[model samples]
Target: MKKILIIGIVASGKTTFAKRLSQKFSLPWYELDSIVHHNTATGRYKRSAEEQFEIIKEIDIKGAWIFEGTDRDSYQCLYQMADTIIFLDTPLWKRKVRILTRFIKQKLGIEKCHYKPDIMMLKMMYKWTRDFEQSRNSFDAKLNRYNEKVIRLRDSNNLDVTKGTRLS
Candidate 1:
């Protein structure tokens, strides 16, 4: 429960769950995407795999943290480092709706995003979600190694932050 890794596809509620869990435990949270794509004084740039690993290691030294993002080969080590892993298995229909809603919000300037909220990005989100489903068997196999520490959630709201437990 100390070091948590929340992994999910786009619009799977990883960020929301991480925020709630972090607040409940008074622990710092991080977006893995931010680590991969470093934002600097000049602009955002994708960091080298080695640089990303260094940043992750620096954060790991802090003892406890919540890192959330879609799975990436660059940070596969997170699975070994995390004390717990949360896989937000939100329904495909819900996630699809969320993707559209999120895009609308971002385009309307009601929501913030690190990347551009354009048609291409929206298309990519859907593509990623489909790809995730196609590759879920492999992902599940990878997670099987850490089954004891992994919690699968179909709905983020079903988690009881106060008790750090799942309600259903």
Candidate 2:
């Protein structure tokens, strides 16, 4: 409830959920991508793992926070510190639709992203969305070892961050 970590595949609505949760709970929110993918004059580039860990450590020391991202490896420390973990188990079809829509939005300059949108990025996103099942299996395995309360949200429509309720 205090320190929350949200993990899921690309376009799984992690950012949206985190924003809603942050507003509802009045907790600070951080997006891991913004930390890892530092915007530069040449575009976005990932920070070194050591640097990323250092930044994450700073965030982990905070009293309360809600973080969203898929960097379980670099942010393992934060994962350990979080009190609740939310895994968005959204359907692949829905995720695909979201990916396409978001890509279009970014291309049209209507939506801003941590990284610039390009053909290669779009292709990578599609591949990532397609391979989500495997990634989720790995994520679940890692989470199985953690004792924190984990919430798996399968349907976006069922999620109510304000009330922390899930409708069937």
Candidate 3:
């Protein structure tokens, strides 16, 4: 798709899938994280809601992009800009394993992670998904009006959000 939006829970592989899609489609890839946040000490984006909105508003105006993120930000501006939404609803256990595994790799210097992992950081990551801090569920009720626009994937290993399930 020319204008695709990739969304999912933290550690659900949304970013990885988005990059793959970009390669497949041969289109420009845009990371919401890059535009919406500043790097923390450990190379993690320091989130700022206002900044995110401003950036998304500008980016949406540009149109024609493949944006990726897990946060269910109700930027009607951003949603209207996207032609399709891909929701990656990976299982909880898999998500945890992905997080822990990445943490271990980063800690061991086997692989570089975008963020640092400490006990508190791990707790935040767990909470991020559980509380829908950066997920589709956060905008479930509000986006109900836009069911026609959504592509909900409640279960992992689904073909498509529309075929898999409807959030509202």
Best by TM-score: 1
Please say which candidate is ahead in TM-score: 2 or 3. Answer: 2
- What tens-digit string does per-residue lDDT give for candidate 1 at 1-168? 889999999999999889988888899999999999988899899999999999999999989999999999999999999988888888999999999999999999999999999999999999999999999999988888888788788888756633333323
- Model 3 residue 1 CA deviation (Å) reads 2.9
Task: Between candidates 1 and 3, name the one with more favorable TM-score.
Answer: 1
- In candidate 3, position 168 carries an lDDT of 51
The digit string of per-residue lDDT tens for model 3 on 40-159 reads 566656556777777777766775678888654444455667777766767788898988887788788998755566777888888886777444454666556556656766454443
Is 1 or 2 the stronger prediction by lDDT? 1
Q: Estimate each model's TM-score.
A: 0.94, 0.87, 0.74
Better of 2 and 3 by lDDT: 2
Which TM-score value belongs to model 2? 0.87
Best by lDDT: 1
Question: Candidate 1, overall lDDT?
Answer: 0.90
Q: In order, what lDDT does every prediction score?
A: 0.90, 0.79, 0.69
The clash numbers for all candidates, in the given order, read 0, 0, 0
> Candidate 1: where is the Cα deviation over 4 Å?
161-168
Residue pairs in clash, model 3: none
Indicate the TM-score of model 1: 0.94
lDDT of 2 by residue, 86-151 (tens): 878777888889988999999999998777699899999988776767576666777777634667
Higher-scoring candidate on lDDT, 1 or 3:
1
